[model samples]
Target: MRNTISLRIADFLKSYPPFHLLEQEELKSIAEEITVQYNYKGEHLFKQEDPCKPYFYLIQQGAVEIYQNENGKEITLDQCDEGDLFGLRPLFAGKHYSISAKTLEESIFYLIPIQAFKPITVNNPKVSEYLLSSLASNTHTPYYTESPSRGNLDLTSDIHELQTVHYNKKLISCSKDTTIKDLAGLMNLHSVGSVVILEDGKPTGIVTDKDIRVKVASGNWDIQMPVKEIMNSPVICYPASLTASQAHLAMMKHRISHICITEDGTPNSNALGIVAEHDLIVSQGNNPYFLMKALLRAKKTKDLKKIRRNITALLEQYIKSNIPMTHISRVMFELNDATIKKCIALSIKKMNTPPPCKFAWMSLGSQGRKEQLLLTDQDNAIVFEDQDEASYPDIHTYFMELAKNVNKRLLKIGFDYCPADMMAGNPKWCLSLSQWKEQFSDWVKSPIDDHILLCQVFFDYDISYGELNLVNALADHIFKVTSDLPIFKANLARSALLNPSPMGFFRQFLLETNGEYKDFFDLKKRALIPITDAARVLILEHQVKNINNTFERYEKLAELEPQNRELYLSASYATKVLLKFRTRQGLMHGDSGRFIDLKSLSKEEKVKLKRCFNTIGDLQDLIKLRYKLVNLI
Candidate 1:
């Protein structure tokens, strides 16, 4: 009897490697015995010390990371993608695995059983030579490394970029007889958003959260109603062997979230699993799992710094894929936040005892706003709870030591030190709640040029760690002082309008006139800052809390004032476009995205940027109107 699954497996295997060297009958025979396996991101296929299975693995789809544990640091030896082979060493050695192989992304693997294939290799010289070549060397990975013998494995590198629509393998499904109440219970128990209704071991229909919300919760049906009444029949089905682009197109065409995978890519076959938009997202280059896996196993600052390097690769991929800048920023923010929190925790462990007082590490400026894509200088401060005057010295010393360690570790992890000495390690920036309040009051009361500049950077501070109540209280105090004071607000707004529309009298991009970036476009100064500053001041005027992100602030503003929705939305879109532009420029040049060479930009790129600048002009003009800063401009 022929199995469609094995045929599909054979079809994939015949495209690459020693399998490609084999005859059709021989490949089919081997594929029939091949075991299909699925693994999620970060799962170990085989550990370094584990005995080899009867089979070596081929990455049918997705990536496999082969890494070595060296002195407690996981050094990534190689990453294998589609049609790549690994674990072949044990076949010849008959010993424990040398390196740990794990999934870097949600993957489909075809297991080539060694026991069943001994005769085939004995007959085929090319197959034996290939297998021997891999097992012959300790560090040689045929699919990963390019060498004289490897001779262009012809294995696709871009498969990771555009193939394999990652499906949810958990297979959360229900029978047609299942009641609405029972199905809901099952969904809750599994913590899944949808369930496939199965009949005769094949998917017949599907039910999702929306179905329950509209059908049962909206008073349309009782909980006792069978799911057959609710489940949408004629389910959208595809084979497990589908590409990411294909799945994405299918999902969009069908207007559905869940795509059921069946053996024959039809409703009549056995339900294999599902593919979701969320799954595709998780499997993509923006995958936090890969970085987090590296993060957890890291024991030294250099290891973490290596992880940061990988983050650049992820960012490059995201930008290349044309993923929304807003989404990319959020992922980058989460990764950076996690890295900072881990750094603080590591710092605390370095201390002799626990912290003497509650403290919050605040990330100021770009990081605070969560728009930090390209890493630049660190801008951070420490906010601790007020302590006894006598005990202040000891508490301050302990926190100072911890800050020094964190700052050093952060520096090692690729964040350069602030030129102006604004880090928490500095005594002036590190302060108690009362001291911070006093400082903010002083800034507001003074509103001098230097003070305003300091306020622009400091006001965006977000608590990275420690006591939240202290930070919340400080936020309230800052808002209370600035909410009623018009001069402070107007001054801040005026400064936001200082950078004039990012275009000079010639209507071309206003390039920096002097310094290292002379004749280059100041991406951050000329465009990004004006919109960011405007978002900050306007959102503060509305007294809206918790919207620190420039784009998000504009989104909230659009919601708050429906009349100026278009203006706020325009500003929001401009911010996103500029951020993406800056991030791409930074990635290309390997800089902080502050400076851009005008010669590098294409005509379309230049046009898009100037359009965003026009929106910034509109924003700066609105600030002039609202704050009555006609004289300042």
Candidate 2:
């Protein structure tokens, strides 16, 4: 019986929560029976211990604070804003309210009649389970204890339980008949300090660089002497996946610096790869310099692509090495950025001229922020100085052509083309400075749908190349126009808050229900972007300029907002962890770091993800409070 508006509410609600279990007709019926209530700022919807109303509430517009008395003090337990379902205790437990629900600002809420909804809860098993789980979570018992059967039992194991030692997979070997010069050439080519002498795919002996130095150069053996002459026999071998402790014991037992990884755990089983003690130590330590250098020297897109494979190798090494996540992220980001920059430089060289009249290419979204470790779609723009109207077409043509080449090159470099086509190649994005100023001004002043769309992309402008001054000028214009536009800030804040929390009311992971990523969690959109966008808006509101790095911006914001420092710091840590998780997932899957298979993650990873979600929940509450964006949508 509900009209389009109520049906839309029903449609939205059915995408989440207990409502999601309802049939379309049932949802529409519930939607029709619901009463829409609007409250002004600081208004109370219900007070603690008040008699239960006939209905539970869902935030249709603004935020509602759920406050509970803990010990002697009233503390804010949680905040329920748009699309958030609240006040379900009455329906579930038939009890008076244990918490007070109040409007943080002007708010609209849909009150669903418990009498009508109760029957569906009893009829739908999924609905019943969802409500029970939701109530369990809100009741504040330890999450794992609520369902002992489903608890993460694996967490009982110590961190050491997950420690795994990886060895090199490729083994360098040469036949005994090979000349010493050819053997040395092979060793130099593979950058290995030693080579195994194999007779018919079986390791017969090994010759190290030391043997070459002491035996050959010292005149004990000739340079032309066969590797078999200087080779050390009785080589040791071990199975792959040896633990660090076991590897140490094996090395001690054998008194050898290198262990040959072979089939069936013996030297006889054909060498797979050499695991030198030095290589093990290096793998255990944080050394990104080699990878960074590789990134810098990468000439072709294919070379960068190859280096990207090493990034995963390096990441696996780092995780095993126990490098701090922050250090890992910093180094990985530097390498990723360097690759992009090299790609840009190469793309520019392909251009006909050195960009007409000085322009800066800016990367937007995650890349602009330099938090992108896993390859994502490129979101970029081109900003040049305002040229005379007569010269505009020519300048625009040049930049557009350059952008086309750059975008194409980036696609080849592994950054998928933006689906919305929001790239420098787009005329809307490839703009001159004065034009950009006008564009941003319009977005700030009017903020129509298109302008809002543009703001989301353009707001995170980071200078990738060309004149820094031109980019700064654009930033100045944005601040100048937006300083007084509270509405614009609110809009951006609302956009940041658009993604529902990564967790459901039952505190289960929210998975993509549709698209190619169905059943997978969208860490990028649901988690990373929310934090990144929130940081950008807050930084812009503080008039902080040119700081596009999301985590750094949050760190800066923490200093600026003392009262919210802890929340911001937690946000920063969460961002880093989530970025690492996404990077690892992407590296494993060989795709953009977006959809993560929740089932594939270990228990520890799931727990870490949930912890990050807690931070996101807290940050979303803060955004809702600070921006007063509750009623905007």
Candidate 3:
């Protein structure tokens, strides 16, 4: 007969794997021998090389992170949540534990004794095979696959951006004729922050808690007024079938907190439910929303710097959870953009007077392309409105002071100064619109090998602040000059192919011959830069502007050239793989992930990294042939 505790344990065990394959009586019998334990957050369950415990663990609640110490740094191998089984590999192998497991939160675990579980595995071939396969693959469960060499687990697919979002089916709504007081009451009754305004069974407008607080309470308006007066009309609506990424984009693009879900995703259709930014934040467990809020509220540069640490932590969590790189890149880019905007805002306050004229702050290189993830050197420039020679000196002087203050804030916030002095604070980079145009025209019309490097850096500019028209005009000037110039494109292609192939004759990584990083594989120079350079030249030739990201450029290229769609798509995938690889290496080593130590890589990892080299070689060949750079090289 089963006791209450054993019955409770069996009930929970029946839902997870292995035990899910067992007969009820057998599972209950095994559960009777189970011992339950409790742990607090940050507590360690086991350490690397410790003798294997007599049992394996199943998380009943909370989370555990499995990690290993490498060069005195803890590298996270896997994270286990409720209903996940761990510590089974050591038990099966009869060897010491190779990694340490610790609680990420206060946790409750059910320890299944090996003595009791061994007999069941022998009788159930399915259970034994599952365990053996999971152990051999270095995976904690069948749901995730782990790489034996890097210990990184693949938990998500690349197309997670297309996953349908979960919206609130229990939508709180009111009639447009309802008074503000009643609408507030309706929202309070349902414990919701928003109420959709419906007219004739369709959403006509939406009123949120902010509307009430900002208009009625702050403006001291009559509470008896109809909601139509304060409610925002033509409510943003999307189909109930909207994906998570789509929902996020809609909310961001509209600058709204809530989105109305309708039958047809248009305001004309009947409302099905509502999706809140908060709901998506909770669903995805990525907290860019809160981080943005903190950034907006921050008063000092130190506060912004502190928030950047949280951003890094959030980025690490996203990578570990296997969030889609596209979504990750977008979130990080927005946060970085916001940080810079806030810095400029604070810097303006330090000035005795406002700007002399319209200007635009430009972020260059990787940041301009929206592909930056790690805290790297800052690359920025300034472009103000074109001015006559009379007032040009004064306008330039005022903006220069402002740019210097902004640059100092960024450095304090952890972005290192560019070793080559490529920041806006430099007089050479901070220029009037005409000077920038002439500078670009000079580089494009006269394409020197050395000048191509500067062109590459300046071409991918994104406006961080000030006037957009200024930057747009600059972009227009670039296309105008480069559209008819094939020589420049050829030189750019030659630059892309300057680095030797990433792989040597014997399938070894091409190591740097000499430098501070001697014998280390330059992932950036050999792999990333080639792909980026090719993308830039190809996009320029096609007259495609605003698509600066290398992978995105390849994806766009795939659409434009149907005959070579396969090659372009392969380049896109390879770009993402290499970016993620570099990010992981940076996070582990606490430095730029450009230089890779070949000795540290597992054979499996080496093989995976090498797989990307084939696409690189093919891309270089295509660039050489398409640009007629064979003779030039």
Candidate 4:
């Protein structure tokens, strides 16, 4: 029987491929009978039409190319690398090989007996499904037919075709006796460049900004000139339902910038609104000022909540409009930050008095990092001044009361309470400056479980309000303490690598098999958190303070670590792409943007996700090497 060496091979095999579906004992039995074959570069394992061998191959190292004859031409079908399985088709077909399998480079492969594999597949549905799915994905078919059959078929239809129609609500008009100045005032009030001369609400000519600039403004006509003096005869009018494309075409056909929307299709009908060429472009949902204003004026939690809905709606519009994710993320972050600040301000007003002493309310975790796209949980803290011994307790009590109100209101506004309860409402987290320093000192010196938990939660504290000095002092204390504790950084690095990559061997998506999110990929836990944790740890190691945004942190890290600059930049790019993807998914699915439905993604999206995984893999490698975590796993 094969011994420990073969068992090791079997154990590795059991982690991936068809072997993973076998019972442990059954797999070990197959492994015991397998032969390890080594091939040099350009060596052929099997040629076309050769008799089927008793053994099927699993690549141990290097790569093997599978080629099939197409008419008179030899076409390479696939390349199998380490841990990849190939040459299994012959076992099932029970015929001579249909393709030639040759080594692309020097390689080793475990040859499992076809006789052993056949028995295991007899009862293993998962093994059968996995093998069949892999085979189907590797085969070439008509592009249109192949895609619709795959799970990602729906994403093609998800691409929204921009609608042509738009709202034109800016109407302009003036009485016949109205002076040129009054006509101009009417146009300016409506923020338009033209005024229609309406005599008894019938067909009339129109005055444009060009007329004002040329005749009235240039002193060619008196300021008191009547509407008849400068108005262009025969107004151009269209119905309100004109699509954006049609509007553009009409404007181009007539060589005009504006189209007057009238009650009827002609200039004889009363004008309702004007559709300008610029309006069509701006109508594609480039307006964030409206949402910002709504947030600022929001008086109650319900009002803000209603406006928050609008913000998300606006976000969906932005994504659908194909705006750059960077611009959208920044705008969305600003709006969310402003909303939180407004909440805090309103909360403070509801309190008995202004804060007792100087303190800074901080947002922690994703909110702290400004990478929170979909609202998740409330992770926040408070840092008050170090008061005298007698007054400290009273001050702490007052801030805790304030925090309670704030946290409760925030919860009402839709942010879930932190599962760990690491919120400002917790007296343990809401502390004075000296108390915070003492807390950090304890965490750094001990590095215990609870302390590590706190470190992970609180390390990303971002100043949200109060005295900047108070927050700066807290950051200074953290840097001072953590700079001396390399072990803490190492612990953080280990934690960052806790989630193994979401990509399996052979580059297939690794999805959650069970739990609340069965069959869905946990983008937050599997992808985002690891990168965020890594960025925080790496930045802390660099003694950088106050930069909590994940992409920004990585960009800063790239600046600091020149050797790993490319990797860091790639990490930053990946973080943005994943965040944008999550935001889009959340907007589409109406959830917290944590779980992604792999079946809904298109092939291009799948490729983008794979690219993100590559970045994650590279970053994980850096973390492992830097922390010497090879032994930890």
Which RMSD values do the candidates have, in order?
A: 23.0, 16.3, 16.7, 17.1
lDDT of each prediction vs. the true structure?
A: 0.80, 0.73, 0.82, 0.74
Model 1 CA deviation exceeding 4 Å by range: 1-162, 165-286
The C-alpha local distance difference test score for the whole of candidate 4 amounts to: 0.74
- Per residue, candidate 2 scores C-alpha lDDT tens digits across 1-633 of 528887777876775566766788998888888888889988988887888888888776765666677676445445454566767777776568877878765888888888888898888966765565445445311111121122322211112222346777777888887778888898899998888888777788888887778888778777776778878887777777565556666778877777777776777787777778777655543335555666677777788777777766766655543333444555565666677678778877887677779888888877777676666788988988889999999999998998888888778767899999989999988998888888889888987767777788788767877889998898888889988888888778877788868888798988888888899888888888788777877788788886777777877777788788657766776777787777667767777668888778765467667867877878778888888865643
TM-score of each candidate? 0.59, 0.56, 0.59, 0.61
Task: Give the TM-score comparing model 4 with the true structure, all chains together.
Answer: 0.61
Off by over 4 Å in 3: 1-286, 631-633
Write down the worst ten-residue block by lDDT for model 1. 148-157
Look at candidate 4 and tell me the lDDT of residue 260: 78
Top candidate, metric lDDT: 3
**CA shift of 459, model 1, Å:** 1.2
Worst 10 residues of 3 by lDDT: 150-159
Decide which is better by TM-score, 2 or 4: 4
lDDT of 4 at 445: 84
| Local distance difference test, candidate 3 | 0.82
TM-score top scorer = 4
